[model samples]
Target: MANIAPPVEDIAPDALLDASSSLLSEHPDKDRLFEQLAISADRAAVAGAADTAVGLAALAVQVLEEIGGEPARLGTALAALGRLEYERGNPDLEPLERAADLCDDLDEPVVSATAYAYLGAALVALDRPGDALAAVSWSLAEQERVLRVQPELRPTLKPVRAEADRARGLACRALGRAPEAMDYLARAVEAALPRTPAQRLKIAEAATLLVEDLLAEERPEEAMPYAEIAITALGDGFAVKAALGRQRLIRCHLMAGGLAAAHPLIEALIEEARAVPGDLTFRAVLADSLAQSAELLPLLAEDGGERAAERGRESVAIYDELLAAGVEAEGVHTGRAAAALALAYALELCGKHADAVAPLREAVDTLERYAPGNEQLTGYLARALLMLGDALVESGQAMEAAEVLRRATELEPVTTPPR
Candidate 1:
């Protein structure tokens, strides 16, 4: 039962502060939602010898057949099994293995195809995109073949179509096909079908991929609603959910040219990264976040407009952090992060007529050294060159600056953030 709350005046500063910082404050009803999930998990985890449990159990094994015991899918299956194991408070690979076995026993191609989708999902989560792509492809082929010839299985296949679309959409997105990925995912969401726990997860994946795609298209205004849906579905306790939430929030600010307003969210993600012991991705992105964050800093200066001086200061700070991180060994992604930051600052202060020689040279040098031939790196390389040219012009090297800028124009246009 709900209790009467105390008067607002009676609350202490610490109490109010703590309440504001609670999970519910950050995410709508997260605590209660997680509690209910735990409850559902508890109830469903207890497998009886009933027909339903036995059927699902066999289906698990069938999925294993399609997976062929690859280590990637095996690890994915193991993690899912681990969650079930924790819930049951006993060693229980039986449920997972049972489902795999069922996939093999099911005579219907549609049912087998659905099982393969689940098995493929396990591979996807294990960072084995190749295996995931292959598995999803096979599942789609089976589903298509069955749907065309064996219309008898339409009852099951129809219900599973949205799930298949959703899974395939996520795989395509992970493989980096933003436009095609969104097409399939849009079908899944428009289906508006009820989701089992399995389908619910696919929904979350599709939503996240769609969100990333929207942002890359320079359409956060379009992405915001999808991000909201994903947050509402995934809740804050899940790791990827939390990380994505932080990124979307920061992006929302940047899209508005309001990066200063994003300090709280940026600081929170920074702290979250710090809390994770040895989180390399978190650390690398944290450096970029810091740079992305300075977008709101004022670029204008009084008389002679010490813009380059101010810009140089910001660039130096970021470079110092990159040096601290030993970013040279971290790959082009990390190095481009720092270079992009300096380049942004240099371009902003272009009219300063200051000795752009040092920072501009440093920016291009760092980018040239670090940017490998990766697609995303190529985009960063373009931005760096554009700013380097601006610096050259400011230093009374107009001809050289024009040449560099022309070179920048030859790069493939960058329209979105990299995943």
Candidate 2:
């Protein structure tokens, strides 16, 4: 009898697992079991049940290994498992690496290309940019070969091409090859034109990446369109990526001196952020957004200083709450310090130098305590010290100002021409 795969989408993961076990014991059709498990795993992943997805993917891999006839199937299973693991934040590279090797042993260029592409993305996430570049290069080459033979597959492979290009861009950017990175990123954006809902999200992601790279390179004008594209493509989605796209759009407006345009978006962002429940990271992002908005407001309108100060206060308070809640993640400390610095800037803009002094001091102390001698934080620390010195001087503490200025100068020397 031929093996028939069951409809996995209609079943709950627990029910599917139970059914799968029963079928395996009664029928023992390994291929059908593997297909059911893999399809269920994909469905669970799409539904955001990551643990269930991973469990199902592992079972699929086990079934494939026991069947052991087709290297391509095993390779695909391993790649799927690795991708799920990477998305789950566990990121084991071995499976992706092994999958790439297994796929390479077959004459299936499309499967090999996809496996290599997955490996490349996983490598990029693991910070092995050199390996990522090589893997993606292989993937792209295989894709080109497949395209040469099967020209009809172009539309179907566009998303694959976009993903490979995006990974290539990221790897090139990490390797400091700016020109190549920009080219690849542009290609990714071009290839990711929306054909479906999933494709629209891909377009938003690609455009967001392009916007980030453009902004980092001090080309906000170039970034603006991509930022707009990302925001527009994201539509009504309240996911973190959607929020990030909106934030980047606001930043593009701010950098391009369109403070009026940024103001309303910032307000909407705050409102949206407030609506999000039980997400500490999103709250932290909201605090940072508030700080940026506060900084922008002082230059925007006549009553801007007062509104800026209020926003600054709110930003600082949020950071305080986060810190008090024991959220000791990677950027939380730095973000807290930045919030204090922004609040101090807002106070100084209001001509309350005395009021600014305390926050400036807090900013400096936060950095010194939490990230002592971190080279990456040295610039922020130095800027905090300089601002604190200025506030001290304005507040009639010339002696303390001189001491703080000396520390700032020691951390980041200010070059002066000979008189």
Candidate 3:
């Protein structure tokens, strides 16, 4: 019997298992059995059967250790386990780190690069973007050498290449390097096929980021296509992508004069955010969107005052909870400020003029404190000040109302319509 397995070069990963299995059954060879186990583990992993892959790879590791401390055999088994751990979102870095070290010591550049790519992905899951960048960049560098030596390695490198690009792009985006992030994400989308959920997720992420950039630049019309792409590619199972796609779609609807279409989606997103604990950003956006839609409620419904007040109270409560949780991000603060304005407006609608004053002042203070000199917030600030002035006048404080209204008028030209 041949104690050593043939080199896995030029073999398709999916075909490798069957080939090794045939060899193992015919020859009863330890090396063939180990290779079969490694290939089967990889097959499970690529099929999204992560737990099965871990078990198969663990068995292979044990067999290799029992036979002898064979570097190549052990390295392959360890890398398989490490890849599964990364996919499973394990926070502990020891498995991948150890696999990477083993592959490096074995002088197996392809396996080493795979290990590093997965390690970077794991680091990204851990929210360590800087370390993710370093790890993924190392993977890319190693892949460069491996490809140079064996150009046929390209097929085998696809998943690692795609993952490395995603990790790098996400890390760059987290660090505020938007252009670089977009470029990497674009490459990631190109590298991945939009077939499997895992593959489509990369495309969805890239498209969503592109849409957000366009929206931020006030090009909602241009952003529509990418949002459609993300929403379609993401399908139904992706909660984060679905929320983001719906969020962008609602904004596009509002900009395109389709408030009727936007209202229910906004409500749905708010309720969805309420159900998911860590989705504070989406909750803040839902609150902001609901506040924006409050102005249109009277036109949309006969019981608009009650409906708008309910939404405004919900928005305010969401922001309050976020603030109490120590979330001081600019997006959260902006949402809180916008919610205050909506709450004040809702109170005014219900004829509670004196009760509206506090939220109006809060809107003004939050806007000025967090978003100073922002043109968008300038309009909102002026409106909030005017609302405060009106509330004071209605509450029998004419002297104070005059000074507040004068400040409101002096801050900006009256570009905004009466609230």
Candidate 4:
């Protein structure tokens, strides 16, 4: 909610409902609920608690009970609270399950449907795809049940339709069914985008996750445009966005073999690193981007990529300092990521393939430990494995090289499938 767009009154209800609050025709103090969510999200960001999201949502629920259970407030509160939990990484399904029961008690179709949307996302995150699928199905079931009993609610259907679409799409993605996922996610994006503040956030988040999956499948070209839109949508003031933007930009440039254009950005990123909180992952990503840009420099210049590589190396050194000073998991992941890329280039150029193995292996271990399930770290993994293979071959270990390459190739292909 901290970086989320402010709600606009004139937009369609779907865009409106998908955000910090939901639409309930009966609740008083509903607006206050939205404001509280915003404040809590912002506070949680700086505080960085694992349970900050749930704690904030719980507070909202307490406030709702004081408002006399206006139907409007109830639905709106449930939607907001549900979405917040989904973002906070709560996958228990119990919170959402209880929310659905609350909506059912009030006989609110719109709220009921949206609750299912929340349920679907939570189920997916928890790795219960079938249940996630069933939860969405149940949500639709509840929606129909409500509309049949209360025909008056049918008119405000756009956001509900869109919400359902987004939820279903999320389930598809979790199933690893990309084609179905793409179709559903695209519709959800269309339905929720530019309208629902919450939905747009979902669209942006989904797009980012999808692009990463695509890239992991090694389909950079397919992921490129999504990554671009995602970066733009991420706006400013969000540290994660800053890191993701540079990551895709550097990658796209590399895929296009346009190292020159990437050079200055890489330089700028290194400089940018100096000003940011040393512990932030953004600095680490900047460091890695610098390293990647440096490695590409040789492909575009006569002087070789060493200059950029050297600058990147310097940036990496700063990240090292931050880590030594007790940098968080974020710093560890990003620093490891940058170091891995830089080390690969350094070892390859210096003909020290044997020595390169240790750093590459360490990079892999560090990234896996600190940034598990993260797309960028996955990229680092791919790069490290490839480098190890290259080094093994360089050092007259063709058998080992072949084994490594085979493993890298296998790991790389599934990550980025065709759009």
Candidate 4 stretches greater than 4 Å from native: 1-77, 87-99, 102-108, 140-163, 194-202, 256-261, 302-306, 312-419
Q: Candidate 1's residue-wise lDDT over 1-419, tens digit each?
A: 11225422233323322343332233343333233323333334342212222222223323444336543333333334433442223333343334445555545455456555555555555555566566567667878889789778766665456656665666777787767779988777656354333334446657777777777677776776676666555543356555656677577656755545566676577567656636655655555554543433332222132343343354356446556777656453344444344444544555543454565566666666555675666666677677678767767789988989998898788753422
Summarize candidate 4's per-residue lDDT along 1-419 as a digit string, tens digits: 32334533333323333443333433345656545554564345334432554555555665566566665565656566666666655555665676777776775667778778778877777778777778788777877786788777765655565566666777787777777877776666555533323334556776776676776676777777776666665554455665666667666656555567667766676666656764456556656755665565655553344565565566567567657767766755556566656656665675667766766666666765654576655666666678788887887889988987786775543242100
Error of 2 at 136 (Å): 2.4
TM-score of each: 0.49, 0.70, 0.63, 0.57
The residue pairs found clashing in candidate 2 are: none
Error of 2 at 193 (Å): 7.8
TM-score of 4: 0.57
Residue 110 displacement in candidate 3 (angstroms)? 5.5
Q: Which stretches of candidate 2 lie over 4 Å from their true place?
A: 1-10, 28-31, 64-105, 193-210, 225-245, 276-283, 293-298, 302-306, 319-419
Model-by-model lDDT, in order?
A: 0.53, 0.78, 0.74, 0.62
At residue 384, give the lDDT of candidate 1.
Answer: 66
lDDT of 2: 0.78
* Candidate with the larger lDDT of 2 and 3: 2
lDDT of 4 at 393: 82
At residue 287, give the lDDT of candidate 2: 91
Q: Which ten residues in a row have the lowest lDDT in candidate 3?
A: 1-10
Which residue ranges in model 3 land beyond 4 Å of their true spot? 1-59, 68-76, 90-116, 119-157, 171-177, 193-245, 248-261, 270-292, 296-306, 317-336, 343-362, 365-379, 390-397, 409-419
lDDT of 1 at 340: 48
